[model samples]
Target: MADKPGNQTPNTPDVSESDLREMKVDELREEAREAGVGAVSGMKKEELVKALSEARSGSGGDGSGEGSGSEDDLGAGPDGGKIRRGPESSKSLKYSQEVTSPDEEPEREGRSLVTTHHEVIKEWAEERGGVPATVGGTEHDDHLGVLRFDFGGDDSNLRHVSWDEWFKTFDERQLNFIYQESRTDGNQSTFFRLENPGREDA
Candidate 1:
């Protein structure tokens, strides 16, 4: 049977010595970076191997080799998976809102979550380019054609929802507001909160 990542002991190396020997220096450097060993761009293969070895050992072989950065800082779950959020720097009350949690698995899956940076979307919109999307066309029902988001870049990756459907779900989720960010497709992506719009200072 194939071994699980958690099966490795601290003493056991994740990458075999033979594998490290076969990997190029660039590959070694990338491995070091993923392992969160800094200053590896100039490192030789042997140095990279040692550094990565240490990182793997120190990480207790849980498969996530992330170093000192907090999970919050990395914007990932404890398992090093991406969280459904936006960039850390975003803080606009105008876009502030809570996220609606959907079902675990739908009978029919919807579109993947939109992960493009909001800035990119805005730029695309300003350029007069819109993401190609469809709404309300299904086996059970069909509606009029394509929907585009002038300022919401690449809604192609996002599921389409009618305003009525969206508002219903939104209210059900009790989202009071919404916000967005620039870093959307990486370990660095984040979710920010906006100040309450009702505040006089806001």
Candidate 2:
């Protein structure tokens, strides 16, 4: 049987990849947290699975191993196993790369897919004076340099980084949306959809 939300017991059975696929995003995120994967609550199932799998095998999180492992090799453990991949690497991102905007904006949606247009982002940044800088290893810096998330609640501290660093980590982590909200003063917060919004495949 599937585990209930907020009731994940210590004795929960091993979750398989197929099972993980069937679970809700919140469930997948809980499982990812149990496995010590980072920034998974904001990810799609496939991306969550990949990240959890990477965490299990210690591939992407740390730069330790060499040579790519078998893709078909699902990890073996209490959690559904992860596919082993080559050593994690970083890539460059195009600051001017166009982001696909969503058809509509949902107010107060914690994580919503939005457009990745540069002009749009520039205007938003201008409102805030400059982009939020990615700070040191503080608790708020939990999301690498991609985002500023507050693990405690909805009061997420949105930070900013250079367009270069932002796009690079965005691609590396396979992210696809921005957490949206309306402050008391009637302003907005946004992030470009890093993943191809229209693609079904991971």
Candidate 3:
């Protein structure tokens, strides 16, 4: 006797390492959490991919996997992978300097500074009369869709949001804020952009 479609067991494919590698770190972390992997918050992208792969393979008992307990395995930094703070003088982020604190000065006028620090972001926005906001109609259920700073603009598309909500989404999305302290002419500029290193689309 043939089984009904509703009663039939679906063949769900196992998540592969290659597939996991294609996903962003945040997405992988969510997968790990759903797979019962512990201590996920501290894991790096590579660590998350490894753990999720193990869990899906059924070889990872309790889904803790291996190498997930040590601080080194978690990440080597003061931010513990949650926040990235540094000068980022590296050539990879060409023309951009890392700013870890609100008090840090830009390398020079018009020099772009990048950071994941909440304080720096907040200070930069507030200094320009900008407030935390999200694009209206861009929400996914209770989750915020797109983040923006509204400088008392007349645009009705922006919806005001609490700093807490903005930061929560920012961290969750693993975003970096890039902005300039001043223009080349040394004037206060509102130039800013958001970037996600994990996703090409971002």
lDDT of 1 by residue, 29-137 (tens): 5566666665453345676677777776685222333342331132211222212332232333223232232112112222122222222222222233333233434
Best-to-worst TM-score order:
3, 2, 1
How badly does each model clash, as a count of residue pairs?
9, 7, 1
Better of 2 and 3 by TM-score: 3
Error of 2 at 24 (Å): 43
Model 3: pairs clashing at backbone N, Cα or C within 3 Å: 87-98
Residue pair clashes in candidate 1: 86-190, 86-191, 87-190, 95-178, 95-179, 96-177, 96-178, 97-177, 97-178
The best candidate in terms of lDDT? 3
Worst 10 residues of 1 by lDDT: 102-111
Worst window of 10 by summed lDDT in candidate 2? 75-84
- Give the per-residue lDDT digits (tens) of candidate 3, residues 29-65: 5667677776565566787778777776776635464
What does candidate 2's lDDT look like per residue over 60-166, in tens digits? 54221112233112121111111112233112122222223211334443434233333233323433344534434532444554343222233335544555455
In order, candidate lDDTs are: 0.37, 0.40, 0.68
lDDT of 1: 0.37
What CA RMSD would candidate 1 show? 16.6
Query: What is the alpha-carbon RMSD of candidate 3 to the true structure?
Result: 19.4
